[model samples]
Target: MGPPERTILGSKASVRRPKERLEREERPRRKITVLPTGRQFAVVRMDPLAMVSHLDLDSVAIEEASAIKPKKYLVYLDAPQDLPLPQSQWCRFWVQPVATTLRPAVPEEGITSDMVLPIHPNTQYAKGRRLMNCTPQFPFPHCYLWIRSMMSLRVRTKRGVDVYDNDKAMTVSIDSHVAFMSAWNEDSRRMFALRRAALSSLSGQTPSSEGKLRKSPSPEVVQPNAEHSPSFATLSIPPPLRIYRDGSASSDDEDTSQASDDAESPHAPTLPPIPPLMALAIDTDVFGWAADPKVPFVPLVDLWFELEDHLSPDNIPSPVELWREQETIGA
Candidate 1:
């Protein structure tokens, strides 16, 4: 048989090329917004008297006495939430009253007192659990509570029980300013009446005593500066509120230019002038660490008496309404 003709091969141009794997289109990663860091249950307010009343004490009379101090101001702290499971297993809570000073205390000098309350691990961070009772009364107007967590070694020794603490704690500052203000406002009328009665009684004292009292130092009077005296017109007239879009005061030139523009466009709608911004004052010193440097103190909680209506939404004025009120007052 004749040799089979060799099969003819197609030209390379006509031959199909192997398909390359399709490149995957990479998806754009989602942008994550980080939230501000805060504690789960750092500080919350509770009725100090009610907390003391509920304590299981051996003597009911002692509990009653503690709960019913006439002149004493009490602050009670309770665990608002549970601690992490790991921490709850081994951590024990403790609180100590530390002295507060105008200047930070030197750790080497020692500021913590001997009055430390050790709390059980099971109820250390339990929700609604009473932790400590704090009294703002001290030599200083303000004081700090040193709250710490210590790990129990679970070992008992004859000499003493050994405990491990990383020296980490949170310090909460308690001040009598708010309490004083509230008391003062409540008794102001009675205080004035008592002062008047005392002044009348002072006339009955002996002449020798009166002489000594008269010789005591009198406060220096402050006289107003005559050179920088404000005139009646200046006192009666309020400054014009010329706020710009960027919260800056408009310059005289800018005001004049705006007036001219307004005059040129006689039918232009008039926009109300912006009022001065109201500033909200917040006291930040309510949270601070003790002067001791040995412990790494975190200022995580602030305990203070705040009025219920202090920052209520209903009390806040809308921007437009505020501007209108200012205009009316100025007129």
Candidate 2:
């Protein structure tokens, strides 16, 4: 029969399939639903530097402004009455107590009328009674609202600015910390989540070499607390002069010795006593939205306020004090 029935030892049926094809077949397919054109959201572009320029002031002026007690006001988000309930919730959720300081435009002191305006004249609805510096009582909610609402929400401070007329109310956008949070897309959020998971997994695992390296080092040679030695007073003494037998060169020897000493111990480098690091335990669960997977974005409002409190005039250290602190740290 056709060449002894063609008894093929290695047939195509015996060959193994490619790993990539098998993996692709075994992999779970992700369902991607096409969103309607109306459902698609767009990120509003903002020029942070341009916005900051509107609120620019000299350091001395800023210091003076900080001294003045900020006037409190209840800012209201004027959303359309016919708007859907979910969309209108921003009026309550985002709108909160805000503080504003009166910064009147003085034309005489090189401060023109335009300098006092809340925003640049080119911006829409950029009218304000005067240039009033505004900050939200709760920065996160306000920033979230501003970002989500396409930066269209205005700061209508009628009571704070002593203006009863709704038409003339100080209508300006919150531009101070707008750059803190961004409207991240789904892909960005997914990538961030993956990276965070990878980092967390790596943190729990100990490398194989770690234990060996730890045991290899001698205990006496490697002091764990060597950097944290007790504080001692350092004395600044000139290098001892070498008196050579030849009369031609005691001064040169002294100079050379002093140069070498200076090079070896310039500033007589001293390690400062490092204070024990006290962990500040914070209850993050208080922020309900932070851990919520449904809430795609979380504003960095928590960090902003904490930093603001520390950087406040009362808590802030002077330049001289900072210099002294740096010297103590040997920085």
Candidate 1: where are CA atoms >4 Å away? 1-181, 190-250, 253-257, 260-264, 267-331
Model 2 lDDT, full chain set: 0.26
Error of 1 at 284 (Å): 22
Please give the range of 10 consecutive residues that has the lowest summed lDDT in model 1.
149-158
Tens-digit lDDT track for model 2 on 239-285? 11222122436897899999879768867766675544421212333
RMSD of 1: 28.8
Supply candidate 2's per-residue lDDT for 189.
Answer: 51
The model with the greatest TM-score is: 1
Clashes of each: 0, 0
Q: Can you write out model 1's per-residue Cα lDDT over 142-209, one digit (the tens) per residue? A: 23222221111111111123222212112123332233223223233443344344434555654334
